[model samples]
Target chain A: MKSLLKKKCHRAGLIVVFAIAVFLGPAHGYAKAETAEAKSECITCHTDVKKLIRLGWKIEKTRPKPGKSAETAGKG
Target chain B: MEPYEKIYVKPSFLKTNHGKIGCEVCHNGDTKDPDWQTAHKGIIKDPTFPDADKTCGECHEDITSTAKNSLHYTLAPFGGVIKARANKKDKRVFEKVCQAKEKHCSACHSSCGQCHVSRPDYVAGGFLAGHLFQEKPCMDTTCASCHGGRVYAEFTGANDEYPADVHHDKEEMTCMDCHTGKEMHADATGVASRFDLPERPRCEKCHPDVVSKKPKTSSHAIHRNKVACQVCHAVANKNCFNCHAGTDKKGLPYFKSNETRMLFKIGLNPNKTKDRPYNYVVLRHPPADPRLFDFYIKDGLSDFNKLPTWKLDTPHNIQRITPQNKTCNNCHGNVSLFLQKNDVTDWEQKANAGVVVPQAKIPKPLKEISPKWKP
Candidate 1:
């Protein structure tokens, strides 16, 4: 009787584990896929903004007097 | 200052409905190409501009349609001022000046994408929260990005001379709390100035009892419609001086402010409408010089004197107790507090003829401005 009861309890524990995995497994996979998608092909390098501005990136580069002040103004 | 990070897309944003719609839906780039250059080919970068009706309007038709005429998008008032300032007599010069205005001034204007999707182009456009189509774009990033120079700076006590506006300092209120979506979208007000907007913020809107009825405070009763609120409430704030507009070597628009300094002055109201019926109002200098667009065409702003350089101003820096409210003499008979003839620049004197107060016009110090209350 004890052995039969033990076998039933073990079977119940297995079912619970399988149920938890069944619930969480797809969610885990979905999260990973979403993360992968987040690293978009667009962001794989070359920003549309950077390419447009790369030729004359004055604000961050030379920091012209007005640019410097405007930047400092924002610091306020 | 990684430029790439400015345009970075976050993982969280990818999970949003907008991101789920995919890039090609709005951006329309060739995603199949492995090379970034090739992939970016045939891309409709920022399809929201000049034709948001086709892109954003597809889903947000009502908003996009009405927003086309909004102050933010058209920047019509500023454009009007630009056009008004130009030499309208010479058609060729006017066209050249307008083209220059387009190159320089137009960049400062807002678009649907600039506000809703990304940071403003004025601040060098970047993705906001990894390009989330935020219902209300973050205030600090979007609105403050443009108004940061004066309005936001003063409101937040970023100026060392001034304290934060009570709303910001105490309540921690962001701009949208008062500005609202209707204000941002600016529903079809057939008016030029924001001051003329019917839905413009009124102090009475929040503090009705303070001004609506005969209040216990005698001063409130005395100054009901005579003095503007900012005259008594606002502290010293920055006023931008000559803003000369020009283009860089690459023909990118830029402006240089010769000076921006803290000032507080009261002047006669320039445009006293029904909403702002006050006879006296706080006047602050805006960045205007008759020669603003001179770089493009000689005397481009030949008609600059049509509008006052020192316009009616409502400074964002508000306080309950300011120096002006301390005593009757602090404002009344305070010649220095008012915009005197000397205060106006030599060239701007003509423009500000209506704004400059004469000695005779100054109000006498009242013996009893407030009988009931000390404050």
Candidate 2:
């Protein structure tokens, strides 16, 4: 009788665990799937929106002033 | 930014979950080919438009299905008003009228991107913050872009001499505060008109005790049962009298109209029901003619009396204390502000039926005031 009761309790525990897994498992998986699918190569180069502006400004910084020519830039 | 520069300056769709997919998934341009012409061939400008299933529906299936049936997309309310006025039982003729209007009037639809990412197409949408996906829609920028050209102007005091709505001016309440996403994505139940929707927002829903809280005078207690909140609160608003639509020489559709009158008037309710069973409600002349699309349809909207031309309008410009609230004479004695036989023309008398107050129904003045009215 004791052994039979222990077996029944074990079965009930398993059923409860399985039910929780069945209910909560997909929701967790779905959230992960959402994030995983969101990663892309577009972020690699275009992560920063100010890339174009920064590039233009950087080039201007490197370029010689209006009065100074490319040859005379470093000397000046 | 300059109009031409908007394309390049717009940022890539990188931050959003949508960035996970390759550009080719939504845009049909050839990114592999080196040649500009060949690569750019058949590029789809708006992919999530008309049918959001290809893009937004992949994730937001629950919302997209119902959103498709939403009045904002289906424009069934606009169609309902038009159909009611049409009085045409012939399914064939009604279908033709709907098709013709779809070409012209149906251009103002809110697509997925129009709300979630950029401005509406009507306002010449460019990317909001360089193609960044917006989690929260900006009321001033996004919602007002399309609606602002009229309602927002009145609500926010953008129009000259018009005071802002108390809800906006005092509470600083935005549209999103009252209009929720659940209401916006009203499950695809295929409601014919917005007025028919059970979940349509009402003032009493929020302020349940407004009527219980008695005012200083008996006017509120007396008229509270018969008058709508807008009739007492809303100030004079712009009403476009007549709108004549036609295609230009270049085939682009254009709408020209008669003068817009700024006036306040009380009229009979067009759509009277248990919910709005009031005898007197605020009136507005919507710029819809039975012959609006006659240019396209041979005899479009020939029967106009099917729906009242003077519609029961809920103007956005509401105030706690209006000119009408100051004295009983302001409203009770005023005939010019009442929708009567004299207000409508002979031709429009039929279309304005159920909207004009009969002489017998007009409220009699309690006292006579001196003629010192301001223009």
Candidate 3:
């Protein structure tokens, strides 16, 4: 019980610090940087779809049952 | 998902109009650092949530303003039902229950980005298509991701015992074909249930001729206003049992439910109206129980009997030849097919009293019948 309470407190502390950081004002970044090109390095590392699927990024191709016991479907 | 999939951005997205806005504007994160956590210190994970009046709202003001109240975004109807059953007299306990509702139930609610850009957070969100803004969210991927447990699964005939809905099998009609963009993006000002919406999807909306004065079939003439279409057409509909909610050791919430499939039941119409004048309707037991909020506050829903347990349902497994349509005797004399008084326990007996069909109320079998309704 004490350990669970401590973990909750630790999470609460992090949330408070994060909230303060947000209130302090915008940090140094390209929030309003204008360029001829969008210049997104985000796509640099995130475009590999096949790897994501292999790593369990569920992109269900077919309609699969939500659970095991749900049945082949009803007596339709 | 791998860390990359959670943050996957398509190269093609960067070329689109939305992508041209740059991630910094929407995310409000640092571009100087490459460290994922450090750079995303103050990131707005979903800029189009709660209300998108600032980011995407700059471009699409009208939709962003109204979509906030959409059932997909708010899921407020769930709360409405809870509130109806709750003992609002105890303000302190009621307030605590509301927080529990937010922690567990509302955790699965959606936003624009979750639909068009990525999977829902509850499903361990990842980009849907390299962050490319889709005009229509994929039926299987986006819609089914949330509704997979019931509607999407039953409609497409994922249930091995039942064939697919006639519309899905014959006409290849998808959810968007009937649901429409207008209803989904509608202004839900004072709506508690989907049926409360003025422009909800109706079977009559598409099949007008079947409801004509001089109907082609005798079955339609007899049961048109008296019975719901699902009473005759729906296959074994899925019915869920007691669902309980609790927080794990890590303080994240989850739900556990017991359900049964291929069970078709008929009961008194819970919510009848001019649009749906059916006296008898299909009833599906939603996985809601009094102990659902016990994890937060014991017996929070003190007045649980305020609403019926077996609520009205429009099951998706519509077929041309349902067991009920086999003959009049298939439904009339089959007391087992109806939701009887003994189906529910004594505690739930009060909650489901209106829906449970009495032994005397079950219809008697006729001598002859025909499968006349083909439309």
Candidate 4:
């Protein structure tokens, strides 16, 4: 009876571990890239996933001031 | 000038790798040399014209060759019809007729840029999305702009008499959904007609049960080999008549067509080609006269009737449950819908050779037949 209880406990522990892996697997797979180069490489192949990075960078360089319209910012 | 005309304002895709390169690289104009007239000098309107290899080939080599060889680019059907109708005896007259068609009808040729970017030239083309590249082509500007007057109109129920195709009306399926990219980039061969193309879209492709040798119902089993699907499914379609040819003030060739009653008629298949062996099929009157080429050369299309004016056609209007499927009596004895002797005039009788069904050949009604009309 003690051996039977041990077996039951082992089975329950296995089920719990399996359930945790199944739930957390996708989150681990989709963990953020470690570097900028890795992120850029991912975007290159999956271009449809997001607006291109170059567009954002250019807007950062040329975009108007926080309180001003682009036309007014250009004139200023 | 509009901000779109300035060139660098493009889609995000164009801002990547080779796309980062400016438009002037392919378009070839004097953007750097800024004398107003000089800036516009040597500018290529369509980089994909004449040879797509110079531009589109840089990225898509496989598609470029297939697209170049396609019927839309070659306009092979028009060329085939011209050759078939031309008088074989007089070489000079045939040459002149071909020249006229090349000058006028050839304006509708499809190119890479036409489908992927701008509209066709005939419809006054410009950049469709303020100069952004479109991955999925716009169906209206790309396909319907060319096919609008007849096929598109019929499919969309632009004609008040008929309802739209069940695929389009209920499911909202577009043309490209069925007509695959392989069909657009056809096998590298010149086909005389759209019917002759090996990859032509068919009802059987989608509705496998409809064409099965052993069908679900008795009527389908009986009619499997004898009748075409369109004969049962198609509704009244716009038929063109009395087409007049004239030259515009700019000396450009133009033609006008007048549409007749919207009706369905089953006639003998004009071309009994291997692909279409059925004796009965839906007939369409393409807007062509015996004297279509008269403006260019007298007696040019003298042998026009050599090829039938009433063509075997599958019109866009299709329904799963048509009136013909209602009962055995609907079509089994409906002689009016079948091409009859009196249907063709004396002048056109020769052209409509096998189309006119003999009164005796029509199937006898199953039971005690009530005579619907006086024969």
* Candidate achieving the largest TM-score: 1
Q: After superposition, how far is residue A43 of candidate 1 from its true place, in Å?
A: 7.5
Off by over 4 Å in 1: A1-40, A43-76, B248-252, B373-375
- lDDT tens per residue, model 4, B1-375: 222232333345455554555556677765445343465588787888868987888888888877887877888887777677777679888887777677657878887887777776656565665456666677776788898877888778788867898888998988887777778878547677887888779878877776676656556666775788888888877677655454655555566555565768888876676667777899877776767667678777767777776778888988978887666778777998888768775767887877877777676667633334221
Each candidate's number of clashing pairs is: 0, 2, 4, 0
Model 3 CA deviation exceeding 4 Å by range = A1-40, A43-76, B259-261, B369-375
Model 3 TM-score, all chains together: 0.82
Q: What is the i-RMS of every prediction?
A: 7.8, 21.4, 7.7, 20.3
Name the docking class for model 1.
incorrect
Each prediction's TM-score versus the true structure: 0.83, 0.76, 0.82, 0.76
Query: Per-residue error at B165 for model 2, in Å?
Result: 1.1
What C-alpha lDDT values do all the predictions have? 0.78, 0.70, 0.77, 0.69
* TM-scores of chain A across candidates: 0.48, 0.45, 0.33, 0.44
- Higher-DockQ candidate of 2 and 3: 3
**Candidate 4 error regions (>4 Å):** A1-76, B1-13, B16-18, B368-375
Candidate DockQ scores, in order: 0.10, 0.01, 0.08, 0.01
lDDT of 3 by residue, B1-375 (tens): 455566667667777898777677888877656554576688888888877788767887788787777888888788898898887898999998898888777877888888888888767677788788888888888888788878888899998788889999999988888887778777777787887787678887888856888777777777889999899999877777777777766555566766664577899887778877888899887787898888789889998999998888888878878888877788888998889888887889998888888878788888876465444
Could you tell me how far off, in angstroms, the CA of residue B152 lies in candidate 4 after the best superposition? 1.0
CAPRI grade, predicted model 2: incorrect
